[model samples]
Target: MSINPNQYKLSDRTARLTAQDLLPTTVSAGTETREFLQKVIDILLDYVKAVNDRNEKVLDFHHPEDMKRLLDLEVPDRGVTLQQLIEDCAVTLKYQVKTGHPHFFNQLSCGLDLISMAGEWLTATANTNMFTYEIAPVFILMENVVLTKMREIIGWNGGDSILAPGGSISNLYAFLAARHKMFPNFKEKGSSSLPSQLVMFTSDQSHYSVKSCASVCGLGTDNCVMVPSDDRGKMITKELERLIMERKKMGHIPFFVSATSGTTVLGAFDNLNEIADICQRHNCWMHVDAAWGGGLLLSRKYRYLRMAGVERADSVTWNPHKLMGALLQCSTIHFKEDGLLLSCNQMSAEYLFMTDKQYDIQYDTGDKVIQCGRHNDIFKLWLQWRSKGTEGFEQQQDRLMELAQYQVRRIKEQSDKFHLILEPECVNVSFWYIPKRLRGIPHDRQKEMELGKICPIIKGRMMQKGSLMVGYQPDDRRPNFFRSIISSAAVTEKDVDFMLDEIHRLGDDL
Candidate 1:
């Protein structure tokens, strides 16, 4: 009854083998696993190809109901095969607008860099929470190094920095830090600890995030003062001073002043030097919202255009995802003083940020942020900075400015066809395309009203055509105007020319 080694193994193994044993993962390995991954890679490659293809339409326009019908989106009781999953991905991409397209200018974030894309994929694979040095040690160090370099660029001798989810969260962090710096006990005691109502000031042209932050910080929206801006959209220094004095007289504690480095609609930069001086005179913390214009800091030629006296500010909110080619949601809020964020937002959860760790715990930054589980936003930015280098970034800044100038020049050349809002201070070129009926109407109030309606009409037509995309909005006195943002490094002079030509082509008959 002696069994041979090969025959014995085959008989035993065959009895144990089952269909479930061949399935993938916590289940088992299947032949289709690798094939499914390859299919995913193929779909991803096709997406990248479409994004880089200038001939490809930026968006495939469809209503929500239509999209629902086009995509057979339904949850199944059982899992489908790899082939069905691959088809689902393809269908999802079919309707998604290619934000990376060169002609897509509908949002502040509009470009993709291969280096950053690689970083994002790696970060996803890492799939680690940014809650402690134990989980994301490499990412924590990368974040520190990147933030230190950014602080140095801002001319800070020493400071602290944190990568927030977006510019809005960064702005919110600035508010929280400023509030805590002024009143350390406010966090524990709440806003009621203050004898006077807490108030903050920002230009009417500043992003709406300031008011949103104010409300989030227990300061009512009414406490966020909308300081008047000059005709060119820069904050009025005299008005700011007046408002501070008025708030003091009304017994409101004016503790924060936010200066805009680049306004949302107008792309205007507030007078940072004058604003800093006013903040000092009023004993208010200064925070600059450079979400859109901070990339100019890399450009020696244009840094002075907006970031002058930024080093004097108490804090800055900068978003690399906007103008610089970093992927979306890479925003950082920096403080001119060390330990401000820790004092403001730290809550030592016993489960995390333990005091008994063997390593130097100073490297752990999760305690310094309001979020416990943050995304690894720093890696993409760090990888981008490494690939592009400082000089590459400076060149990128210069090129965007040049392209914006080109857009303005072209708009001026066709004055009868397009009305320039004003000369752009940054890469935002805003103008209204004059339809055939509205041409040479002497720009009266009624004509302005009529032109306002034409914007949406033309925008809808452009959407239907699926040729180009640009943003449109109305300022206080101005009507809705097309704001073509040259934030994408992928865009060229040809694309700029194409944008103008497309606008004319779509709008001429409107």
Candidate 2:
């Protein structure tokens, strides 16, 4: 029984055997396994090419019931052949959204960096837990190096950091650290042991994760005070101070203040310098949630303008997966205090985090996080960084800004047909598409209300036509409007023009 996969045609081998024959310890399964993986890789490569092609649709949209009938999602009692599995992979890609598509402006996290994608494949192949250096030695060291460099970029001389699942978890970690640091006994004693009711503060325009963190941390949602934002969507420092004073007067302890570097809807950056000063005066832990805007820090031109005074923050949450265009699940939380995370999160699990390891136990970082089996998310980021040096990333940032400026310019060129919400300070270009019926109408409350109804109808047309995707949402101050994000490096001025043209084609009659 020759095990050489090439000896038999793929169709013949797949028809004869199932996945059980491809196990590592199975008799001479290496060649067959390699062949199977190669087939999957070939399918993935084709999908990647299709994603980059401008002619391809961003997605083949389907409702829940339709999707359930389209794909065979149920698990069967018997194992399927490798050939069926390969076909299944192809089928999955056929209906999935091409997030890396050139016209994908729906999310803050977009684009697929080839280097990072390769790194992700390698990490998946390694399949090792990031908890201990014993299993993921290279990745563990790479994480430290990447985190150290990130801290240096943030203008911190030295600090500790960890990659989290996403920006929300990163913010949660910051909240936990602040709470534990302020009241060391709170970790063991819970909220009952606290000296008083603990409260936190964030801008009304900030991510909803801040409020969620407060709820999860046992501080009621009402305890998370919402500071007022200015017309530009920035946190008003005076309002923040006033709220802190009000909370203090009520005998509640103000322990943490989260200043959003980039607000979600409007892309507004808070006044970091002013917020830092208020936090210092109020004796509050200053945390900056820079998950969406952190990539701008790579551009020296924008960093000083947008993220100035970030160094004064006690903690920061930055996600490379967003603006940096690394793969998803690459969020980092940095703390100015070196030992704060370990002191706050460590449970001293004797079995996993053994102190008697032959190697330096300090590298065993399992105990520093809430999860023991963390995914290896650092390799993709580190590899992407290596491929694109700091200057390359700066250029990428500058390009994105240039594209956003071009979009704003195009929007202004057709002012009669489009209404700009506000001039964007970041890559988020928000505006409204005015139908021919609404064109030349007075911009009043009634007109605004009528215009707000246009987005969802046009969005539905876009989906049904399989043209492009741009997200729409109603903010605190405004109704539904198109909020286009320019995160992918692949997006060009031509794509922007097409987006506007597509919207016109879809909504001009409405």
Report lDDT per candidate.
Answer: 0.86, 0.91
Best by lDDT: 2
Give the residue spans of candidate 1 off by over 4 A: 1-31
**What TM value does model 1 have?**
0.94
Query: How high a TM-score does candidate 2 get?
Result: 0.97
How would you encode candidate 2's per-residue C-alpha lDDT over 1-510 as one tens digit per residue?
111222223657655678988866577888888888888887778878888998888888899999999788979999888877777777788888889998889999989888999999999999999889999899999999999999999999888999999999999999999999999888888877788899999999999999999888889899999999988899999999999999899999999999998888989999999999998898999999999999998999999999999999999999999999999879999999999999999999988988888999888888889988899999999999999988999999999999999999999999998999999989999999999998888898788788889899999989887889999998878889999999998999999999999999999999
Over the stretch 1-510, how does candidate 1's per-residue lDDT look in tens digits?
Answer: 111112212123323443233344425444444444565676777788888899888888998898888777888876654445556677677778888989998887888788998899889879987778888999989999999999999989889999998899999999999989888989899866788798999999999989998787778899899999987799999999999999999988899999999898889999899999999988999999999999999999889876889989999998999889798879999999999999898999988989999998989888999988899998888998999999999999899999999999999999899988888998888888888888878987787778788889888988888889998989997878889888888999999999999999998987
Where does model 2 exceed 4 Å of error? 1-9
Q: Give the distance in Å from residue 167's predicted Cα in candidate 1 to where it truly belongs.
A: 0.8
